[model samples]
Target: TDKPAHARTSNLNEELGQVDTILSDKTGTLTCNSMEFIKCSVGGTAYGRGITEVERALARRKESTLPQKLGADYARLSGEKTFVKGFNFKDERIMDGNWVNEPRANVIQKFLQLLAICHTALPEIDEETGNISYEAESPDEAAFVIAAREFGFEFYERTQTSISLREFDPTSAKKVERSYQLLDVLEFNSTRKRMSVIVRDAKGKLLLLCKGADRLVNLNIMSAHAYNSDLFSLLPRHFISCPFSLEMKSAAIKAFKTSVAQQITDAKALLTSSSETPETLALIIDGKSLTYALEDDVKDLFLELAIGCASVICCRSSPKQKAQVTQMVKVKTGSTTLAVGDGANDVGMIQEADIGIGISGVEGMQAVMSSDIAIAQFRYLERLLLVHGHWCYRRISSMICYFFYKNIVFGFTLFFFEMYASFSGQAVYNDWFLSLYNVFFTSLPVIALGVFDQDVSSRYCLKFSLLYQEGVQNVLFSWVRIFGWVFNGLLSSVIIFFFCVGAMDHQAFRNSGEVVGLEILGATMYTCVVWVVNCQMALSISYFTYIQHLFIWGSIVLWYLFLMAYGAINPTISTTAFQVFIEACAPAPSFWMLTLLALGTSLLPYFVFASIQMRFFPMYHQMIQWIKADGQSNDPEYCQVVRQRSLRHTTVGYTARFEASKHFEEFSEIKSH
Candidate 1:
């Protein structure tokens, strides 16, 4: 708790306040979290279709009809990478492994099957609970493998270490590679933007097969197709003499058999959930024994695929990308960046952030275990920030408004009654009414109103110290407007009731009157009730433009019901006849009229609120623009003055911490300026 999530690394702390640039990962962080393996390139040929990082490959059979024919290598690449492999038709480039095409899975559907009967990643059964659970290395990889099983592909048992399909790599002996040794499988990271596999292929050649963002790839299929379109134009025509390039563009494709596994080897599952933790796969590939390397044409084709690609869509992304990007955002913004992810891959980023909130519902315990704050829902973000944390500030501010007005109005009434009662032998309601009214009806309603206040825009303004300005005046005005609408029609009943009670002295004799002080008392109690309810209603309504949310309506009814029950059974009901008369007043429609009057009075605040929305609410986006356009409109000077005071207060608690650190002098210097 002493250090921020991302501050575990010392270098990041030094770069604070200097974040003038921003860099982010395209997947999961900026974009929704999804990764698939689609598209592939063999020799120089590219294949597969679709935008997601996850895809299915069921079309490239050795016995299919297309631009070219499928050979053993192309079929093997398809089975492993989950992309359709092989060539079609009389076209030499397509069959000769001289060209690649990203064919849509639906391009040929009969062959597409997700056979689930026999598979490496099978559902595990529990005896006691009859529960089902299975394990997969990566969430995305698991999805494709499951999808293949679901469609119709049965798990063929022909594996000593690995598995492949028939008509592709027949004879398990021929299907296996000698030089390429499978190294450790590392998960993708949001920060790194890459996932690599180490392999030692034929002739003892070691190479790192990296598949991530297509932009990082070396070849594209579109470029080559466009390059040889005329060659493809002739039917039964084939271009068998295209060269492969080492430099490539857009590594959007992975080549293997058209099958998948839960995990490549028998290892304890580490990064199963979708997280931001830095996941890396370690593989060893030997290049010395390699016979076929991508030529220039193949490289150009990959580059074309990388450029102009809308979404990284479907590439096996690495775990490091997730963690790295979160750090990048913090560094670039020069501020704390909170990243909430629910995957094992999200761990590094979670540890690397100033604050890391993890969602723990489904992704699993690893993600939740690494998170600082775990929430049950995504919508709770607004609730956490707006309704709970900042509600305290809003409640205090609104209370200050209510307090100001109540004291002023009550003080005037008390002073007036003191003089009149001394002179005329009577006053309005006693001090008990003044104190009891707010405590009972006003307090709960107002507090209840506050309990429900939350908004998208309100939180932003409140965060920046823009809620109020210049202390007393700001406090004074918030209530002026609040009570102005609150008391416009209210003053009439108060004046009449004050006079009638003083003249006739209704409190002196109880049975002489029933509706004696009814107008004033009812208006006073319910006006305060409805106005605060309106404030609650208004606060609720202001956000969604509809005041009838279940919470708003329920809070209103719940508090009123509680008060009604209290009035029915309270000891005060039997204390005095005057009290009993007031309490015994039927649930009449009269005060409700007064409530309408109070609601009507609130119309005056509409324009003021509109001005706040148009002026105060949007002050951040165009604070300077509003000033240049008309600071007089929202009073930019007061805004700036309020801004300075509030900012200093927020940082005050951290002062000692800053003081103990070497950064204090620099912070103080900036503050002084």
Candidate 2:
């Protein structure tokens, strides 16, 4: 509640702490989803060196020769440059219309034209500024349109059936108007990895322009060796319903497979020549291939290949496939799963996982509504899980155990008092006092502990991510630990009863032969129970702030005040009982001795056990494990390996893997945008 992150359900917070695997969406969730025209491939040549926006700004500053607060380096080239909207490059050969004179000028022009007319992005002009902007279904399409505009092929207008573009015609050395009559559009879907448009140009030539994720096309080649010409023939039969000629489609498929194979061969050669491990590369697959890989015949082989690969990119994947992958991981590894996304397409995956985090972004609210936790951005997940998640699990687990312990001690003490009265069912304490003990006397301190008590700071949580393993391994709320707490409660109850009975002048009270003697005994038992429960505040691992201290210690002060008032004013307590309570509670040698002895009896043994366990046998996670080990595994050398392996299977492992992927930078960019 004190932090920016909000949890709709308290129980879900514990699940976040236990997340071992995070299945995240690529766009909007991992990458900035807001596409920047960073690099491009045209005429088999890559252009626009992959540099970020900050690097471009630095490059611009370095090239400037103005006299300023910071001096420019003369070693860097200085020039008057014509800046493109999305393209930022310092190479003179590719800048300021210089690419128009290159040998592949026609190919560049055709590439820009293809980018302009290939999708369903609609252009809008600002009435006031007269500036044109595009509305696109996806960031990739929007980036293409923006790139086309920057390359001198401005998509100015579109109707139901035609697209108009104003272009700089290098052959004519002037700007020219061109219209493409759109014959048909093949829009992208999960099944169709690419989108294409059939448009008739001004010259009456109809051409198909297409773009898609290259990973989807290139990855299938790795498995081509598993089948022969018969399988290739079957692929064409599967696409028989398509309008294209069978021969044309078959030739295109064959060419594409051949090109992909060559690409893999070249890549492997480059890696080998440089003495790099090819295993570090990711395995890429599309939805179609993923489905095939999951078939019983190839499932084992697919799992081996997927797991051994350093990374995987499942391109053009459907929502159902995403959910299937999430389920597969959970069943196989027996690990907690977390899925995060920002769109309706992710709803299935989000609902399928143990913990789902939704980012409220450009996508609709469907994912957010379905998720366990809704966040404003993906990056906030790191803090929400590590800090708040850890605290919530620790607090609730401790609160539950303490709740049980407190009630058990109070109940057992009454049972012990019942023996003194010949197994009578009568309660030792007053009905009102017994009713208020849990609700009024003890509630606030535990509530405060649950809400505000934090064993570690937020900074430490982020630094030592392995601490999150506590929840995953069920270290706090296990059966063994719960029973250990129950044992402590029973021990405390026995100590309180025997100590109070031995210290009291029972014979003197019995000589009076009044019901007031029974009342006096009840008061002594009540005070002992209160003292023992309150002592838990001192033993808790959580750091107590000033308010927490006031909540705990102030409750003890209030209890004493209530006892004094109850003895004096309550009709149930006679004059003799009042005098006995006052004598026992007052500042005197016997009172002090009795009070100190009761407190020490109830608290000392438990405190000693806790200190020994934490200081010397910390690796013994549970009392049961320690007992079973017979003191043989107390040393770090005996248990460190198993503990480290357990730690690596938890949230710490996920965080380490995430950092290695460099996905954090993408999350930062999306948040900044």
Candidate 3:
């Protein structure tokens, strides 16, 4: 949890803000990445009395619906919070060597023995403590070894040709040390979807111990060697198809390539086929079926069916299949997609996504290395995307638009001045003013905007996550917004130029009674430009801090200080700017009056436009801030109310896609059971 989030790429901030669909791996990205053997079915009997998190959730949903029944359920679940890592089995039928009294004790022994003698986990023994720790390629394998040990089949040592275990013999009621001759290991790979280990027991009987995904782990294949062969035949298939399949003996399966293609044609024919309302149907595909479904001819159909369904499950899928699904979703919808993972198997999918987030967890560093962003925990994504991401998008957009506005304001005034002088090339500002305008006067304010400006607080950004839709909609940095800024700059330039020229035309200075020359005119105009642009910056900032205040106000003060200091120097060095501010401009009342007049006039249009937009047609974030100010943000139904009123909710969009696809494994774990 101490692992800090790292942004690997510069431009990914804006992309993170706009992610619409997230395709994530299950093992480590959404999980704790530490595996525990919670439940297992063997010999036609399910062991482990602990209820899964999914069952607790379903129970909570029922309690919430029927409050009168809540107390009874709450009392039943009270004070049952004991948790252990790697081993969570709690059935009294098997715990503390109680499996000896069971009807099929011999079968359980073989299962436990298989767990202890499995492939490819090295044992590290602490000589001082006499405790053994395992280092396996995966958490699942390690969990199996640990669970076996907890059940009194301790796998204490392993070598190239033998696996030694300390076991409790139920018949003798004593602990026995046993060694099995390891023959060969058929390692697990993506293609096989299972791993097997061959070992010769003390009686010289060859045994093949296997484990894998449900689709490939058929107990019937090993029933001939099982002590309780009749019990194995009576076991439940556990191949669940749908909600109502408990009464059905066999599910009517659909071939992936053919059914998907046909369904796409059928879906196109119906008027409401793509409607987003709950349809209660789920699409499930396996690795072998996905192979045919992923061909160019069937890919589009597969995507269409997958998207149209209420949910999708990809079971026994290979690494390539994960990447293919992510790529298909990204390409077909044309929406921004994010992939998250925490293992080497997920690297391809992570890299294929538009935004890749890797979790630094028990899985390893392969995903973290290839990711666009690295986070410590999955929950941190809430802050990453909602708060930091929104801030980044808004800051970049505002900085870019401000650059356009200031450049136009400064350059356009000079363009008008050149036109007013009949193309004589008489500059509107002094050489030093021109040289230092951007570098000194206007630089700090823009830097503050780019680095620290935020439209809303981080807490508020997270509180109202719907505010993120604005960035996804490209509300801040669009062509229309860019053109609007250009227009504002053009208007400011016009007001600053003409107002200065018209007010000072043939006007006399009160102190000296001398007509203002080109130098005096240029100096006054430069003062107006600085005031107008900096005032605009002050108005643009939504949340102001001391840094912004210093930059904005200090820049104006810096301008005046540089002018007086440079003017006080010798006339030869100061040249045209010599005493321009001190003797001519600063001493005259007209300069002050005209400067204030031009500044106010230049900023007047912007003020009106902003007021009108805020008052009449507010954006998503503006409305959210307004609600927060009105004290509605604390209400439980606040997000729902906001969603109902949002313009983005008019059509079913990427938000739904994200909910459906993102963490589907976690969802399936909750609902599929």
Candidate 4:
């Protein structure tokens, strides 16, 4: 909660509510913006305390054949109280020099040594506590270094030409300090997809250590196909339980020297040769492949396949590619898209989206500066979209509809009166009342409703995330709903005018013992209009706060007070309204009866319609409210029950897309939901 949601536009809530798709950056946008060394594989053997999704699937597959469990059966060492902050590995075979007993101990030592010295991270030592903390350009580098330190290969110092490390020597079974003469440090980039360091050990042994995307790392040592197959086997078996039937394809271009035109042709061929059901294809391609995939000739086909899949992973993409993907989804799907990011690279995509959510993270403020909405973390996006967004859309829509209804109710009364008066242009309300109708009498209450109205509690909104579909469907502000309100307003105008004129036509004022004249008739009709419209506002409000009550009731009181004050003025200035309320309208029995009659008659139809709708054919929001009032919303299975009862109206292909950011130094994936 340290970071609150910040909005740039007043209508951002409405936009957020209608968002059918979201395109987000991975690193600081989806993750906790931090990294931990969770699992690792070496020499075809997995070493980690955690039972990962991959291991769980393997365990299930080998359950019948194997006598013991697959993952948890592997012994894990207990963590000490003073454990490394970023290191989480706990496999007994790899902790506390135990790797010396393994057959591949020499290879494991090389791997651990490589992890310790391979990054652009600088260690920050606290002066008082003397604890080492790494300040790195990326989370992955810091994670690797910390994991290496926890594995008994501590990189203690670094100089311009050499690096020092305190490592475990299996020969003497002791920690030995050593330094390696540095040769060169090759930094990583989007194109190379890898970073490597060369060094000369004490025995004049020159060695190279590199880490990067699978394609690049495997290219130097083994055939890409064999390396990829082995690496793929170590991945989590996510496709086994996928909801959609996806034909996963990996188009990591084998050569980079191909011309743009040829690359475009290749990409088009890949798209065309895809499963006939391109809708079920999940593409895993590198940046170079994406270059041709996004070319004008192939973009359409690429979008067709990408938009349909649950995920399209574009590994090692640049900022331009991210923006291109966002624009493609927006233009092709014609759906509202929200882009989220936390770095400079994401600025383009964030600005290109319908709504941009920038995360204030370790990366920087460029994304936040360009965003329409700024938030601290990705988790808050749920409340921002589902709760606040729904509330704003509901409020604005109702306020607009009410505006139409009240204006019609007030304006059309004069139209009806003109017909009765034979087109004489006789005014139905006082001049002051007409002048102040929108400014005072009907303004504040609607403002209150517009700013504060909420149909359901925020908790209920979050609990039933599906309720947000109402806004996406434009249920509240639909053309049909608008016209229905207009028709209701017209109907109310008829009842107020005809009933007022008819009742007053043959009636006599009790105080004066005379038939009601034009002045009294006009004043009485004005009274009905004010009460009816204000009372309509009261009925429309669902969640009433003290401010709402003040505005609604205060509006009515202010109108009466204005009348009495204006009546007290001299007839020269007040004109028609001079003493009208005091002598002619206030004490007249027929005026009071007609005012009450018109008010009740005008509201009765609306009340009945609303009651019937709420009782028999309630909308989704109404049902949610009813459940909340009945205390059924707290049930954990409430959403399932609603689904089973056919309350949900499902719509598919409403995507929420996300990309990977720079600081992650990990794979970037584009997922659609």
Leading candidate by TM-score: 3
**Structural similarity to truth (TM-score) of each candidate:** 0.38, 0.75, 0.84, 0.81
Mind sharing the TM-score for model 1? 0.38
| Model 3 Cα shift for residue 203 (angstroms) | 2.4
Instruction: Report clash pairs, candidate 4.
Output: 22-656, 22-657, 23-657, 24-658, 24-659, 26-659
What are the lDDT scores of the predictions, listed in order? 0.36, 0.63, 0.73, 0.71
What TM-score does prediction 4 earn? Answer: 0.81
Q: How far out, in Å, is residue 136 in model 2? A: 1.7
Each model's number of backbone clashes?
Answer: 126, 0, 0, 6
Best by lDDT: 3
* lDDT (Cα, tens digit) per residue for candidate 1, span 611-664: 676655542323523433553435656656545433321111122233334476
Candidate 4, residues 1-673, lDDT tens digits: the string is 2577688666576777777666656556644556667677776666776533323434444453333453335432433435555665666787788999987788788788888877767777789998777788777788888888888888778889988888989999988999999999999875677889999999999988787767568754311110101112212222221112111211221212223223332322322334543433335566777899999999998876665444445556778888888888788777777888888888988888888888888887898899998988766777787788888889889999999999999999898888888999778677887899999988999999988898989877866666777777778899999998999899999999899888888677546667777777777788888899999999999999999999988988898899899989988888778787888777877777888888899999999999998998777788888887888876768756664452433232212122212223343333321
Q: Cα miss at 608, model 4 (Å)?
A: 2.6
Among all windows of ten consecutive residues in candidate 2, which has the lowest summed lDDT? 245-254
* Model 2 lDDT tens row, 1-673: 1124445555676676666556776456643456556556566666654444333333443464334322232113223444444333333444445668877887777877887898899999999999899998876677778777766788999998999998878877666999999999999876666788999998999887776656554532111111111111111221221111100000010112323333332222211222333223345666678789877788777755654433345655788888877776667667777888878888888898888777776767788888888887656766776678788888889899999888988999899988977887877787767878988777778988888977667765654455566776778899998998899899988988887776774434333343335666677777777877877765774577787888778777777787777667646554333544555545335544666788887888788988787656663233223423455444555445434543433222222344445676888889999
As for lDDT, the candidate ahead, 1 or 2, is 2
Model with the higher lDDT, candidate 3 or 4: 3
RMSD of each: 18.1, 13.5, 9.6, 9.3
lDDT of 4: 0.71
- What pairs collide in candidate 2? none
Could you tell which candidate, 2 or 3, scores higher by TM-score? 3
